[model samples]
Target: MTAYAVAHLRPAARLDDEVFEYMERIQSTFAPYGGAFLVHGTTPEVLEGQWPGGLVVIGFPTLHDARDWYESKAYQEIAPLRTRHLAGDVILVDGVAPGYDASLTAARMREAQEA
Candidate 1:
């Protein structure tokens, strides 16, 4: 299953040279782990709740790959380039399987609730 690395990053102050360097270096870190960006640094058109700062979404072949990419030495070495300057949350999440049904989950929840 595909997995994603999602980050909601807000700049601590203003983006500096270090962040730019991180951006320049980040692509190379993704190559070995089959990681690719689905979204990067785009101002979203918010229709509902508040959203501050940029969003980054990267897709991987699997959750394992996403984990590996994050733990890789090459990435770790440069992670501070971004982390030191940005405030945000990051997560790895598995994608749902093909032909999945929400009704199945609802049924399970209903059963648990009755118990």
Candidate 2:
């Protein structure tokens, strides 16, 4: 089953550029774990609740893969920079259920349409 990590970032003062730079480096480190950057910094207009200023979503092959990438020494080295930038709103959420079968879901939708 695939796993995902969704991060919400609210930058602290004087940390935007540094954090952005660090994130680039982080992406490089995640390559070996079959991680893909799904969304990076998509601004939200609907600011309901205590919304973070920025968002990042990453997809990994599995939950263990995601965890391994995070715990890896390479990521740990650069993680502090991300922490320093955000006012501590960074979160890693796992994707619910096993393997997202979007194609099957789409096919079902098409079948319904044909019906």
Candidate 3:
């Protein structure tokens, strides 16, 4: 299953040098752990409630891969930068692959639980 890391980030009270530095350092670390950016820019149109920040979505091959990257030392080293300057909700999601069916997914989950 494909896993995605989705974050909704609100910029700090003010952007500073530290924030920019963090951005440079953090983005560099993703590729090493099999992470690729699906969305890494501003949202031009607001479809719903007022969200006054940015959204980032990173794609990973599996949930494990996404977890590994987030927990990795490299990410840890720079994690504070973003947290210090932004606030957001981050989530890991497992996606259905091609030809996926609800019953098949349920069965797979059952098999894993049984094991």
| Steric collisions counted per model | 0, 0, 0
- Per residue, candidate 2 scores C-alpha lDDT tens digits across 53-95 of 7777889988888888989999899988777657544445567
Output the lDDT of residue 94, model 3: 88
Ranking of models by TM-score: 1, 3, 2
Name model 2 segments beyond 4 Å from true. Answer: 13-17, 45-50, 96-115
| Superposed Cα deviation of residue 101, candidate 2 (Å) | 11
Candidate 1 lDDT over 1-115, as tens digits, reads: 9999999999866688999999999989988999999999798788999989888999999999999999999999999998988999999999999998999999999999999
Model 1 C-alpha lDDT versus the unseen true structure: 0.92
Q: How does candidate 2 fare on TM-score? A: 0.70
lDDT by residue (1-115, candidate 3, tens digit) is 8899999888876787777887888767878877898988767479877978888999998999999989989988888887877788899888888897899879999999999
Deviation (Å) of 59 in candidate 3: 0.7
Model 1 segments beyond 4 Å from truth?
Answer: none
- What TM-score, over all chains together, does every model reach? 0.93, 0.70, 0.79
Which candidate leads in TM-score?
1
How does candidate 2 score on lDDT?
A: 0.79
